[model samples]
Target: IIATVGNGMVIYIFTCTKNLRTPSNLLVVNLAFSDFCLMFFMCPPMVWNCLHETWMFGPFACELYAMIGSLFGVTSIWTMVFIALDRYNVIVKGLSAKPMTTKLALFQIFCIYLHGLFWTLAPMLGWSRYVPEANMTACGTDYFTQTWHSRTYIMVYAFFAYFVPLLVIFYAYYFIVKAVASHEKSMRDQAKKMNVSSLRSGDQNSTSAEFKLAKVALMTISLWFMAWTPYLVINFSGIFQLLTID
Candidate 1:
């Protein structure tokens, strides 16, 4: 409920307030929208099944629920990648960077959804299959099967959905940190050479902004890795027969 409400508030605030409409904030809005979809369409059904100890909604609902969950999950990850790239451009390129326009943001969002839908629907199209999870109360991609098709699908999905995005996020943040650190060191050197009590007011403000952005980038990457790495490891382990999924 809190996630739903909080994300909803973010969407409402960004949409209703004209002044809050900016290219970067568009990414936030997309993230909130994805979370909202997950919380609204995915959470309640899973919770109901958990409490009831069965999938009361039947097979069609099971497949639909799993697809929606998967779609939103992928969308959220890709949106974070977009956000990281935007921050990288702004911070690393500075004045030379081309600003992200609203049209470009919208196009990026569309591509995110398209990417998500392609993967989510692949199971239905026979790339693999969605089946009830081990608990029998929920459904997802058939991760436990050792068939060649299942293994191929799992590996490909993991590469695009998890590995590639993680690489992009890490790469973008690395340069962002390097650029910020260089700027800070240059500022400190100038201040020391001039024997000034402190940096100029403008320089101080710029440094502070960079520091705050760097902190945000760090937190975002840390949270994403922590939340997703275990799942990826488990999937890979199952694929390689290192761990039994049953």
Candidate 2:
């Protein structure tokens, strides 16, 4: 309920307010939409299963549920990667950066969904299989299978879906911080030379924009790691035989 309502509000605010519909903000809306899809499409049935203390859905429904979750989940991950990259370009380049346009943002969003579709469909095509988890209340990739084919799929998927995106996010934010720090140092030095209390004269708008985007990106990245790290650990443990499934 929290996820559904919160993401729904974000989408609503961005859609109804014309002034909030900038290209950069469109990316935020995209993130919210992806999350909304995840919660809206998958949560109710999962809740039903939880209430029953078991997955009442049959095998086909289980596979569909897992696919929907994985598809949106992957898109959300890559969307954040793009958001971080966008912030790095805008904040680091400042006024010299090319402004984000709606068309370009839409194109990027299309690519994100396409990337997600590819991975999620691979499981259905025999790269791996979707099956109920040990708890029998949720479905996901078949992590318990010990064959080389199954293990290979998990490893490759983890590399692309988790590790690569994580590295890109970190790289973007690391440089974002360095750029912000450098700018602050320059401002302080210039202020001292001019005998002024501050050097922020006409660049307040740009500075404010950078800070806003940085703050959002920071929050997004932090929440992302918090939510997905445990899932990643579980997948890895399963692949490595660290987990014994009944």
Candidate 3:
């Protein structure tokens, strides 16, 4: 449904008009394109797997399908990290970093495909590699189920994918929050000295906005914990098990 709506909108916007294809929107379109790929590539197989719980399509079909799915999934995930970096750069550096040109965005889009290729195609043909066990030939996927690689990849993924992004967001919001707080406190101190009449309106508004940002950061941290922490914990346990085994 999300992909359907989102991609459909992109298609409609891009094809329907020429003017809306500005550089930044074009980047958005590229993102939507990947997201469309991500959703369609990942979901149908998941639905199929859920209903069947086994691959009826045979090994070749499974490999091809899972390869595409996992590739796009990783693409989507990494692209999101890219998007966060883009956003952070924009906020911190402002128009100096500027809008990515259409050509640049297309290059970025190409990079995403290559990035996906490393994870998905490389594993299949055995370059980057995912070694399949005998009898139960499966795609090198569901990192959670692969006890050994899962732990390593999971930790790396969490650190690079989650922690770094959170840190950026935290620092961004922290500065903004602190600036506002400092301004508000200054205003309050001035008000204490002077007439309290003029201080009530915009002062309160600025303070409110600062607190709202703080709240949002808190919520974001909470959601991150809920979303990825369990997988991290599971990986941590697996790592402990390996050390014990050693």
Best by TM-score: 2
**Model 1 steric clash total:** 0
Name the lDDT of candidate 1: 0.86
Give, for candidate 3, the lowest lDDT window spanning 10 residues.
128-137
List, residue by residue over 1-246, the lDDT tens digit for candidate 3: 776677878767886788777554554566567668766665676566557555445666666766775565555555554554454454445558666677876677788778767656644553333322122333433333445455555466556545765576566556555555676688789988896745767646744643564555346445645765665564456445532221
Model 1, C-alpha of 131: deviation from truth (Å): 1.4
Query: How do the predictions measure up, each by TM-score?
Result: 0.91, 0.94, 0.59
Judging by lDDT against the true structure, name the best candidate: 2
Model 2, stretches more than 4 Å misplaced? Answer: 201-203
Q: Order candidates by TM-score, high to low.
A: 2, 1, 3
Using alpha carbons, what is the TM-score of model 3? Answer: 0.59
Which of 1 and 2 is ahead in TM-score?
A: 2
Q: Which 10 successive residues of model 1 have the least lDDT summed?
A: 202-211
Better of 1 and 2 by lDDT: 2
> Which clashing pairs does model 3 show?
none
